[model samples]
Target chain A: MPLPPSPPRLSIGAVAGKTVPRLADLPWLIGYAAAFAAAHQAAAGWGGQGFYSLLYPAAGVRLALLWSRGPRLTLAVMATELIVQTIAGIIVPGQAGWLTAANGVARPALTYGIVVWLVRHVAARSQSSLGVAPMPLGLAAVTAPVAATMAALPWTLFSPELTGVSGLRQTVASLTGFVVGDLLGVLLIAPPLLWVVHAWQYRPRALHRPTLRQLAGLAEAAVVLGAAIAASTLLAEIGLGVPAAPALLAVAWIGLRFGRTAGWCAIVIVAAIVLPFTATDLPVAERLALHMSLASIVVVGYLAGSFADAQARAQSDLSRRDRMLFQAERLKTLRAMSVAVIHEISQPLSTLAIEAKHLHEITVAADPDIAQTAALIDRKAAALSTLVRRLRRFGGRSVDEPSALPLSALVETVTALTRAEARAARVVVEVSPIDPDLVVFGQEIELAQAVVNLVRNAVQACDGRVALSAHQNDDRVVVMVANRCPDRREARPGMGVGALVARAIVEAHGGTVERVTHADGTICATLSLPRPGAET
Target chain B: MTLPANQPDRAAVYVVDDDHDLGAAVARLLCRHGHAAEPFLDPVMLLSVYAEAPALCIVTDIMMGDLDGFGFADRVRMIDPAVAIVFMTAWPTTANAVDSVRRYGGLDYLEKPLDETRLLSAVDEGVAWSRRQRSIRARTAALSARERQVFDLLVQGHSNKAVADILGLSPKTVEDHRAAIVAKTGTNGLAQLIALAR
Candidate 1:
């Protein structure tokens, strides 16, 4: 039986190709044909044409293909089924004729085509990616009965004479066999096949490599699968009541603990051990009872796996976001502290340079020893100043360190750093006195680099003056940088890389940078960042 | 260290800076170069004692806690117009250099870790310029009020008759006053008188 389409979340692990089969699709089709012939040969002894077997894994192959490759391949699917059956000698035109062969082809084709279409329809309405997530048991339960009825319809209506049923009661009994076989096939076969398709398509790179814990979980589930198989087979052979009980309990545990992939594997393993018993000579009621018990196990296993997959995905997403936020925060704090410290030391450094030079001049003529010492001081101070200047240059740093940085200190440091540049450009820089307590959370060095770039650009962009100021509005701090461009023709259409860099930095901190050019020749750039403790 | 003997004609120079150690060091360097140099930590303190005994030149820091170097120069200019001002700053730029000369009447603007050669040369030139200015002012100060008016007109290339008409005096009296202006100011001719005024 074909598995019901689950939500796209679990199914998205595979690359779903919507186009019809090309040369690339031949391998999967050939593989499916081989599985179909093998399954047919295995169930040949069960009843008439092996159609009454407890599990139809071929139904799963059809569903998996239709789910991933889309419904356009239904014709190709019917053709392949006819070819496989003809080669296996199940369809001999000389004996049952072509009509029976046509009915046989039409049965699974119509049944599984509707099954895939219905699954895609439900997945579409829920806005899910097709075949990405594991098939949920709820969708399976809904599609299984429809698949059973559809699979049985072609045989009941077109080939009743071939079925050897004379009346309504016998016909209904024959129909029940087809329904139970197809239903049991879908429940048992489709989920594991979908998972195999997912794993194969996403192998090596696209699929997330399983971590150690996940591998360990799979190993644990494997052990439980082994125990369940051994116990179920021993119990059934001894004619013990509730032979599937241990297997059902083990499947539920695997589904909830190891997620859908492992859960489906366990279910398939358990089904393989128990399903062949239907071929043995037994009472019809007892065979039906065994099929029902296996069906219940399939449903329980899928439901638990679906729940586990959803929980794991939600947890992984939350932690990843948290890690990014922490890194950004740490980066901003360290940057701010370093910038402020550099600005403070710059004045004393200038004094050191002057004093050292003076000392050298005073001692040079009279005392050779003192003169050499003074020269050393002068040289070291000059080297230190060069290092400081290089450090003060705008260079991008790691964005992981962060802290709450005062807006007042940030603006002051940047203004001081750019003072000589502004003077060289013949522009006067006016910083509006900011409230000392106003602070924003971000990487300090990056924010300073952004502000410095803006100020230097403003100086170069304007005629005479650049004004920088900041103010608090609720939980946000907005820093405004405006420059006077007396000649409107000189105003640039864009602030270029400076504004782009600032925008990227501010936006990273969940803020915005807005720039406006006025007709009066004043260009204003405003940076709005979330104040400390105000970010949601 | 023993004090070097002071030159009798040493130029009186003042160094004003916010950094006390830097200011003192610059002053000592200036003194070693044979100038009666003194250091002032604050521009305000420098200004308070400036009027009593004015220096020939002043070297001041541009970025200061109280009055900036420009403001200080302006005040000093009001007290003694001949005092040469040289501006210095930790941060130097083309705009500051232009403003130092054009707006603040500075002889030069220098950046710190001071070049001793440039500082000494600037101070020497400023002292010579200040001396010339003082000499001219003293010679011009000797003229009587009436002769001073006549001298001003003559310096403008006005004829003796035109000077008399503008001053509302007779041509004989105006010519007599011009001679008195030349005698009192020690100017040999109209060209010398005009050169002195400039």
Candidate 2:
């Protein structure tokens, strides 16, 4: 029987490790509820919600909270909204808190849901890049106001709390006031709040307690605030009321001085300084209109600063990519040049060595005692060949196109190749048998080259008394080639091309080659590489 | 100073190289030194000359036209693995060349612009290695079951009395088998026989 095919797996692998809300989330939830209830009461205390709200900041607080915490914390939003709305209903006369609490859940869920979806959609559509992109986040900014207004609109029909029991025109006035207030609140407050939170998180590396430059930025923000407050007070004194149009030219100075994050903070400080003038003795509608103007300047200035930052980031990113491309091309040329030079020299060296050996033999046969000149030539040719081999090893074009290779085969082949050279040097080569199934991820020929270099070096160092051993670590394989030469005074070439090239090849494979000369004169070279498919 | 290459003319040294002049030069040097050496400038020329019997040794360059020294060695290996090999190369830094030569039971390598001494010595070694291999094969072929048992004991350094005691045979019978083994192998004594065993 065909062994009943296993239940068709959805191949989702495992539950994507369920996201657990942390202790940090507990504070954000509690703080959001506290801020919400406090801001609502504050708004009502300044003036009952009609055409204007003096301190409507709950929506802005929600957006700023969600910015860092992510949208998965919708449960936190809804939970906080539930407690705040219930308390507001009980406090406000004739509003049924229990019956209307469902709207609180629905509103945040819809508003943030749309905002999160749009941000995700824009990010997915654009190139996932290394630099900060303000355009997508600017688009996310626009979504918040639209979502807040839309979420509020449906509630207008049912909840008298939002629609109001005033006359139809008054009701119309209140609805416009609601949209203007919420949009202004989110735009004016969320960006600066998010900036502060982000700053606090990475402020160590971001500012390191503010340098002289940062102090200058703070001075600029102080100047902008002082100017905005004086001008707003002058407008109120002259009975022109608060115009709420921020001195844009002066703010630009702050923007230029403070950079984007501190620039947003400066804008917030200026608006906070001018917040008192908007709550003066004027009609609710006029005051609300003034607030809208104030919010407009803040939102527009924030977006301008964001745009400037994104543009600067994009420009640097472009230059860096170009620089890297040019650098990579140069590296390629260097390698090619080295390999070509070695290969060219090899053919001629072969002819030279052979001819020298031949001449040495002839001289010996004819005049054995006077053959030293030929011997000298032969010795020099051999030395040149050794130098060429080292040069080739150093600058050789690595045959290092990577693939998965069995560890045992790698060891066996390298040891076998070095065996004859070992015998010639009077070195005994011993290789420990390893598990044949173990494999490493690397370039096969380059790895072989690296291992062979080590083996050859070992043979040269200690009369070829070498031992090779391999063992598997958790996600890596370590091969050690060791040679024992008890004499300390016999100096060998310290910085050979063979060692350099071996290091290069191993490092390229995300592996390491370490050489240590022991107290007892045992020279050891160890090569370690990540196992196949370990994602190293 | 002399090698056991008595019949040097009978030992054919095949030289393969893409460089025609180099091949001719090496062949000339070997011929002057009393070996029957044949030179082919192209690997294909060697392949084409398959009608002749396989040589006792092949002296080939590592880098050649179309088919390289290694490819030529492999072809020759397929035909007669007993033939010894000696690689002559310009690119001696090629890491795998010498090892592969040793892997195929070749004698050794000669760096290019071939030295008469090294080339001649390599050829001498190749010829001797090839002869020993052939002699071993012939001796094994000629051995009867009982003679093979006697040869195996003698190779282990057993005296004739010891061999007879181990095999439950007469001492004279063991001595007879041992003599036949030595005669078949063309070895002088126990020392040569021991070398042949390796």
Cα error, candidate 2, residue A194 (Å)? 3.0
Return the DockQ of model 1. 0.11
Best by the TM-score measure: 2
Give me the runs in candidate 1 sitting further than 4 Å from their true place. Answer: A1-20, A30-52, A67-75, A82-240, A306-310, A365-372, A396-536, B1-198
Root-mean-square deviation (CA) per prediction: 15.1, 14.3
lDDT by residue (tens digit), candidate 1, B1-198: 122346477788999988887788778877877788899999988788899989988999998997999999999899999999898875554567788999999998875545557787888888888887998899989888888888888889999999999989999999798888888878798899899888
Docking class of 1: incorrect
lDDT of each: 0.73, 0.69
Candidate 2: tens digits of C-alpha lDDT, residues A284-339 = 77776766666666666666666667777666756765665587689989888877
For all the predictions, what are the DockQ values? 0.11, 0.14
Chain B alone: TM-score in each candidate?
0.89, 0.72
What tens-digit string does per-residue lDDT give for candidate 1 at A499-536? 66677888898888877765444778888888788755
Global lDDT for candidate 1?
A: 0.73
For the candidates in turn, chain A alone yields TM-scores of: 0.57, 0.61
Show pairs that collide, candidate 2: A354-B112, A354-B113, A427-A464
